[model samples]
Target: MAASLKMSDDKQETEIEEGANTSTNASPRPSCLTPDRQALADSIMESVKASVSKLRRGDPPTIYIVPQIIRRVKEVAYEPRMVSIGPYHNGKERLQGMEENKLLYLHSFLSRNPDHRLVDYLEAIEELKDKARSCYSEKVGPLMGNEFVKMMVLDACFIVEILLRFYPRCRKMKLVKQQREELEQNEEDLGLISAMKKFLFHSNGFEDPILSTIGMVYLLGCDMLLLENQIPFFLLQHIFKMACPVKVPHLLEKMALDFFESRSMPWNEKIEMNDSYYHLLHLFHSHLLLTPTNSKEEPNLSCIPKFKLKPNLSCIPKIKPVLNKLKNLLPCSNKAPLLNTKRRRMIPHATDLQLAGFKFKKNEKSNNILNVKFSHGVLEITPFLIGDNSETLFRNLIAFEQCRLKAKFHVFTTYLVFMDCLVNTSKDVALLHHNGIIDNLPGSDDDVTHLFNRLCIGIFHNFKGSYLSDVKDNVQKHCENKWNKWRASLKRDYFTNPWSFISLMAASILLLLTITQTFFTVFPYYRPRSQFLIIMF
Candidate 1:
């Protein structure tokens, strides 16, 4: 999970670094996450501790205690005695330190022991799903309002990853059980797929929930191989199916493609290769490479039939009711948390830092490698500061990943990872965090770097989501271009295939027999070789 979060959160950090910490000398390459930064983080933690202490002793407990309580939850190993005393079995009201500790212990037992079998990450996600369902059923139900919805959304988002990646066997089992229980009911509770659509389309009123859930969903759905920085195995298999003489629905593929295409901030030019490369290539190939010397006219585009598609026969009706239910239940819509496209803004250099490649300038050497692979790693944005020389500009430290990758390789889906060396918190470089990493970087000293670090590693850490769009347009085109070239070569005659080679041999033998019979009948004196051999035998 942390592996997936780094590229995004680091971008959030780059924006604020210039104002983050100005001790006069942020020079050369700035010291990363220093002792000074740690000290500031400690002070912020102390303030939180103090605030929590005051709340625990207050006349009535505060409302926003969960995020803080989550920060301090006792993570104990579970024992048989404690299993009987499970906090989840009762209620959140009865959640004491020991019970929290015991639950943590159970989590650790199920999750961390090396001696135990390797339970899948998807199953781990499902375990989280079960806990989330409890919130909706017996415990803090919707009666508790958005708080209930918020926790469910957060946990659901985490599991969204599992569904997208693992496609758990239990998911099928759960659906069977649900259908059996509902019998005549119209809804199937979405089976995880619905949870995602709800967030992308529903969770608008939420300040933070909408950003992570929708974003992650679209990101994962795009293509796991590119996002995860791994090449797709059996690439030919997928390409053959997509490019087969068989037809595919244009609208469905368009929706899927458009979602992958949406991740860029508007300023970036739609890479000409996007839909153009294939479109142009086909046109160019017909006009130049495969044109008849006898014909002077252009090929008609309409000669090829348009692709028509039908939505999943099984899902069409299922999705309809689910969509309507989400609308009736949530009744809200909000704008996406995307940056403005029109206003052209460049990240200015910081106080003393030097970023090697700043926003695809003339001197750009390599693209930054910020994808799902680094989601768990620390994403620090050391900027080109207030004063820097040409030597510093020439010195390459941070690399950028210019292409949008689809995580289709090993992870569930794909999203783009855009790594700008000179990103700002509010201005230039951006820093981001894993879902839970934010708590480690509190800003007690109120220094900008201190605050930035906290925000990256510790604040609203690790909010996973579902995203269909990707930011790395270059990578997608690269992947797609490669797919097209491979597909173009697949238009060989059937006999070229080993399987068809045998069929061709059989057909040839049949044709030879037919020709010999015709020849014998046309010229009666002519006896075929087969007839002479048969008489001799």
Candidate 2:
């Protein structure tokens, strides 16, 4: 009986232990309270939250200056001189004189709207400060926090007031006249430019004893073109709205176009200037290329896929054929075509084309610089008015294109590249100049040629969507034609002058006599030679 009780007690103990084991296996440990696991989970959650926050900020499109491009070109071309528009050049000693003018303009703007407090302008600028900073590719440094906002406020109010000055009603106002007088006085005080030099200027390259108003305006205009020196268009619009509130449609656009009308092209007159432009430079660039009419003639590269090569070594039967294929695939291959559907091509320079019997003529009616055409041995290019500010204008435009994101076509860069290829030397520039296609007002032909050669040194141009591609192909084909070569040879060798013609005729006669002598010498034993000798004897 004692042994049976012991066995039963042991079995009960085993069953109880089994039930405990079952319970332990069925119920998971509460991980929520576990230190290590909870810490890991919390870390993962924090990481996800941080990522979401970053994603919400999104990637701002790059609208700032490309350092690589600026380095390749002249640094002075992208810099401001008389005035600095934005934070990039804000506080420079050279441009600080203009700061006083900016402040006075802002003061005038506030005075014009007596009901509007200065705090209202500050609040509007403050609201746009973060968004404006985000537009630039570089981060707005901590040093530029409040100072940057103040600069924007001052600059925006100044621009609006300047634009307002052009209005007919605004021009007649006493305040406007007084503001103009103050600006003139400031310019005179700063020795910026004399009134006589300002009024005397007509052409671009006219020499003046001192810094003229024309020079100052050109420099200031160039400074405004710099990518780093741009204020957001919306910020300006916001300030103009709060200050003007005149319900004038496209007030800023009208003001900008009127201010820089010399650089404006008639082709873009129909284009609606709305909210698409990011800044003044962007607006000016759009004015350079965009048109309202949709034409199939305009090259579209969107459908074309970028060229990429993949070598399948395993499928090749022989190394020789593979090597041959590779040679053609390589961009440096001499046998390969210089231009293809996927790549940019270079055409002969203006001098070479002229030598090859290609006639260059300027299309006076066409105001668009991109409207270049080649057909039936004639190359027609729209005249480009090169000026003192052209270098600055082109360099800034190129920098803008270089740093742009999702840009479908680089019209300005392509034009620069095309011109670079055409103007290889002073002789080429002279040809273009003599043909009235280029207005060489800035400097000599050599200077213009050198400028163009260096302008597109580091810029890349895709010919697929470029209007110049067709012109290039036609010019290349005409240059490569055998008949054109023969004609050029005749022109150079036989028809250059009276002396050249006489020499060529003399050479032809000498060649005929030599051929006759050679024929007799080779056939000395022939019947023809003996018969001719007997007849002569």
Candidate 3:
């Protein structure tokens, strides 16, 4: 239990150190809790304050946002519940992530011990298999085997690893439907192998420690759960939880408030806070937090007072298609951002384009700048974007397998940053047009677009320093040009089309003639001369 406290306390300790170093006469760090419930109230307040501080500046560069794949051993394993299908008329309720993770593990365990004679254990295993299937069915309904089954198998494999390590003995029983032929009759099958042969050697899971090293890959994530059962979740949770808060809780709180005031949470739904969570927020605020990499520098809110421009619905693209899926569940995101200035804007669902053929280049002309060649036949970094430095930064936090997660995350983060830069630019252009600043625009549309891409390339190249604050305005301008061009294209397509009308008329006449010919042919004497000539020939 005290392990959880380490995250908070360590942060608090760091802040104390910072203060002491800054001021020789700085007060000593606060004492630890005395384990009294009375102190719990105060402790909770302090904790929340710390959480709030971490929220302020955005995540720190050192903060680990990387998705983790930690594996261990577990002593207790159970399938608590199964996720059911949603309403028949509508849909079925799907399994929660945690639930799916558990069932997937259960199935793997049962497969390992297929010969287990215990009725209750066998029944439990059977129930898990069903639940696992239901979970997939509810999530995807019916999917072509190639697409969805592949994903389910991967999911199951990951979950099973948790069990394999937890109960090493689970391997003795056989539970999987498709057992390996080579390792069928022996104890050599200790772990999972690459299910897909073509991608086998190159796959991230191929390097999974338990299987490649040991051969049996069935038990991976389960090992971690078993160890977790012994250590307690609160301890680990506490460590990661208070990393930011203890360091800069006050700063984080102010940042959150500032973000909320600025309307940065525009597209995201509002997050509700409970008492403990609020306390965590407070702790976050106490620490001095780094600004988010993409967050814009506030342009003297008081100096440059708020101004409104007329809305431009004509320029609005079918953003729903673009904004449907930005839903990557941030790992261990306990606190919600109070900042969301563009709430009116659409939140985009990231469509993975797997953009390839990137060329990395350095800019010695400026220490904190670099360039990258993009694939959409153009580069796309103005002042606010480039490669996936975010992934690199988070990689240090939650290390993934052989840095494959790092690579994938880099690609994803890079795409997002590029898109974000474009979006901001588009909005800025619309705003300028509405406000009559079009005449005094910053630069030519082409130049602005080119500059935006250059800036993004610089950001990606200059990971050691420089984020969006270095080039946000230029990026905004560039996106405006792109948006205007896109709007013009849409208008042209909708309003001007000679071929469409002609095609429709021709099709209607052809359909009428075909029907008339069919009716005449059935009358026995209405065959066309071409048909008689064809028969003679």
| Candidates 1 and 2, the one with greater TM-score | 2
Better model by TM-score: candidate 1 vs candidate 3: 3
lDDT string, candidate 1, 430-478, tens digits = 2222121112222321233322222212112111332212222221222
RMSD to the true structure for each prediction, in A, is 32.6, 17.5, 27.1
Question: Please, what is the TM-score per model?
Answer: 0.17, 0.68, 0.20
Model 3: runs farther than 4 Å from truth?
A: 1-105, 113-158, 161-414, 422-537
In terms of lDDT, which candidate is stronger, 1 or 2? 2
* Model 2 alpha-carbon drift over 4 Å, by segment: 1-59, 142-144, 166-215, 264-267, 292-345, 405-407, 489-502, 513-537
Residue 129 error for model 1, in Å? Answer: 36
lDDT string, candidate 2, 63-170, tens digits? 585677455568777777777777667778988788877766666677665557888988878877777776776654432678878888888877666655443454
Better of 2 and 3 by TM-score: 2
Per-candidate clashes come to: 95, 0, 117
RMSD of 3: 27.1
- Report the Cα lDDT for residue 246, model 3: 18
Candidates sorted by lDDT, best first = 2, 3, 1
Whole-model alpha-carbon lDDT for candidate 1: 0.27
| C-alpha lDDT of candidate 2 relative to the true structure | 0.65
